[model samples]
Target: MGELVYGLLGRKLGHSWSVPIHTALGCAGYRLIELEPEELPAFLAREDIGGLNVTIPYKMDVMPLCDKIDDRAAAIGSVNTIVRRDGKLLAFNTDADGFCFMARRAGVDFHGGKVLVLGSGGASRTAVACARQLGAREVVVISRSGPDNYENLSRHADADIVVNTTPVGMYPGNGAAPVDLTAFPRCRGVLDVIYNPHRTALLLQAQALGIPCSDGLAMLVAQAKAAEEHFFSRSIPDGETERILSALRHETENIVLIGMPGCGKSTIGAALAALTGREAVDIDAEIERRAGCPIPEIFARGGETEFRALERQATAEAGKRTGCILLTGGGAVKTPENYGALRQNGRIYHLLREVGTLPTDGRPLSQGADLAAMWRERKPLYERFRDTVIDNNGPAEETAQAIWRDFCAYSGD
Candidate 1:
């Protein structure tokens, strides 16, 4: 009855977006409560717990602690949303509802289809239950040691839908996929519960295969919306999910620009920053700042290899940042490792300009280098790295604005 404590409960929550999400939904001061296994008991016993959404290791842990459990959560054997009223704790599994919403939004039909869920944890449980409820003819839970494990994924080649509930391709381990999506040629839909990277390796593979795929951001936001409704004892219009989703997408997804040397990446990046009020991070400038000298000095100090090493480091650091304009040097796409670094949180745009029109000032590789040959060599790399291509032959501001329009319209659904 006293001041209510409202937030997400988990073990490690250093990079959670829950606070911003709940705040945007008008849940002022909603915070993250990181606690160890030993501390969970005492924290749950507190008299002031108005509501809390659980995650990871504690989703199942807190179920027994609750005084009452919703039938859906009890049926799923997972409880992620908890509310305290009349000094009694009641738990629910809003994850199921959230998952269903995400799938439906992505046009993933569960009716009369086989669903292959790629984990055995709480999330996997919820996914399985929802898939069944949504009319999935069969649901297979795949775990490491289970009979239907990774070793025998070919058995599920007929799976109509694939849902990843594991953290394999989650942030920090960006490109890891639990299973090769190619194994399931009949997979009509793919959903990953890992939202940080925007696109996971599995989802990316699905995209490449021309399968309908969706990232987990919609699920994350929808789950938060359900949790907020439980917290406030009020209903929120479902449209709010899409609204918050768009805002969060634009705010968290990085706008990365990659191009040949002096193709107006820096200029267009600055223009984008001005129009959007976001910071423009030049990888070249960051390398210079970190090395306490210019890029040419770094190249002079060592060679192209040293400069590339430094570029990799810079790309890695900049890729981790949320909601910024990242301008990469010309040679950034040359490094294969930089793709995962940039794709983790960015929508990369390849800025294309006439090779003859590019300014080669102070560029190590571009200084009297065969510009045509360089473009021919690097064109495939740029094409591989980019989500979209923008022609930079016009004014920088116009190109930036055109990119802004496309980026705004790109709903990674």
Candidate 2:
């Protein structure tokens, strides 16, 4: 028959590179399908769909819908990969294998290493099992909700390799690190499975200690490759896989600047572009170019609805341009379509500043306006779209440098 038709079903598990990574494998007809809980069964019933990768909330729920469970998946009590054979659903756990592969590839010596797992969830369990299988001398699970007998030791003193499977240091909360590395002495390695932030607080702390660390990007690529193998019943070319992963990493870590009018979306965006050698696109300028009028005039003549429509179009167009810093209008998040489009190919950074910090004559929109009320109203929307929040109350040049540094760190540039 034709190449197997495979895809994934799950919620929008923020900033996942699953789509690009999977598509890069060149697995013939493989695709990723973002599905709501109610839409899965009907989608699965399709004849052309050969298999699927299930993530997050649907991982456990999908088990009941499977016709058979691989022994390892049953033992692990989770499913991440599924293949359809003779109209029967077979569940498998590629996550464990993926983790093991990544650890080894990263030169982490698991044999006799003292492993510390930072969570007790399904992913943590998989990590613990992988560590043990790789010959870890001891595996300790550390979490506030861990077992009663769990001994929480400082990473500074005890662990050889610390793996964070929890979502603490993930995007939107990139500043919240998982463990205090101050306690752990001379860690050999660290790994965090949250890939969106690429370089998490835990990884940064480890790097600061001169320890070799890795983010979830490699694991994600490995696991996606494994899923592709199952879905296609064939192996993917190694070079193609690497190229796709490189592209995905570059795209996902891109800085997306959002804020209200007079918030320096264009100025700061250009600064960031100059600092990083990346192209910068201002949505409003693009809108103005297309509409042949200024944004305020567009809003005044056609009202907010028409302006939002233009914003959606601008955001969608911006997503198609790679390696560029995108500056969105302050109200872009008000349109789900625009927000979704922006997030499709980039990470969002909310450039925030207190109302009192903004100069009165900054922009046309801020003219004769209630600055405090406007800032307050737009704060929540900006927060919602931000993967990281950078305060713009300081010097623009310094802020640009900081943003550039964080971008380079996040992109592993």
Candidate 3:
């Protein structure tokens, strides 16, 4: 009926990638319905809805309206996907399968192992249920004031797997972690359900510790795939998830430009932003603003260590943002800690330019230093860290357009 309508039901529909995700799967009619609590009943009562995905503040609310509930959704106490089948709406918990997919992607097997989950909300339920389904021996549901809360978190040092269903490090509040992964030395894997920044501080820490870790992006895509299957009544190739995932990850993630000073990061970043309609940020400028002094003056007054501290702070601030073209200082990659901040929500592009041609007039390190030696030292790091390389030997606009074209191609925007 009525061309089969489908959409996402949420209180705040901003910053959702669901529509584009569904579009990628060849579903062109998806809409995002932002409904107040009172609005949900009438909306669910409508028979024309082909399917709907439930988000925060309404996942549990949509359950009672369903004619039938999937066992996993009932067990999880949440309904994230609703399909109107034969005029009767049936509820299902795709999050359960989604979390399972996330864990499996992280190489975390739940075969009678200790599992610690942060937050006892709707998302946590699926994580707990899925962990149990996969044969997790002990599933500790941590809450704010619960018995296994973050306060007494250290007591659970035996935790084999840690899952963060909390919003601790989700966007705006980036760089903050709920608990220290080092506390649980036995932790073999870590997972955070916050997909905005893609990689949370917890996941970064887990990665630093060489523990297998994954963010909520995989789960987000996997759940969307499951919902698509229910709506279209078709079996999708398992490999489809990965192709969509890679495209989404590259597109949704910010595009960061890293190179030596005067290698055209700022120029190319601004040009790229102009071409793509995305914002552009200069990390060196951000550092100077935070430090209340010129970058050259900061280097002169406080030494390179002081400048690095300010750079790290600025880098973390930039990490919280998404879809911006970030132009970072050449030496930003020297400090390994900055990698997490830069990579949390972006992909690095090494702006390769000839050392002799790079500007050095106002740059402190580049002005009198052996530019050749500096390039030789940072060259490998730039090459190793970059997801793509932008050769800035040509005109700035041309280089920027090249990057814009590639980004649009990868993201399909």
- lDDT winner: 1
Q: Give the C-alpha lDDT of model 2.
A: 0.74
Alpha-carbon lDDT of model 1: 0.90
Give Cα-based local distance difference scores for all models.
Answer: 0.90, 0.74, 0.86
Name the lDDT value of residue 48 in candidate 1.
93
Candidate 3 Cα deviation (angstroms), residue 310: 7.2
Write the candidate numbers in order of decreasing TM-score.
Answer: 1, 3, 2
Q: Which model is ahead, 2 or 3, in terms of lDDT?
A: 3
Error of 3 at 172 (Å): 2.6
Error of 3 at 103 (Å): 1.6
Clashes of each: 0, 7, 0
User: In TM-score terms, which candidate is top?
Assistant: 1
Give per-residue CA lDDT, model 3, range 174-193, as digits (tens).
Answer: 87898998899888889898
Clashes of 3: 0
lDDT by residue for model 1 (109-148), tens: 9999999999999999999999999999999999999899
Q: Write down the TM-score for model 3.
A: 0.81
Query: lDDT of model 3 at residue 181?
Result: 87
Task: Indicate whether candidate 1 or candidate 2 has the larger TM-score.
Answer: 1
Which 10 consecutive positions of candidate 2 have the poorest summed lDDT?
147-156
In model 3, the Cα lDDT at residue 317 comes to 85
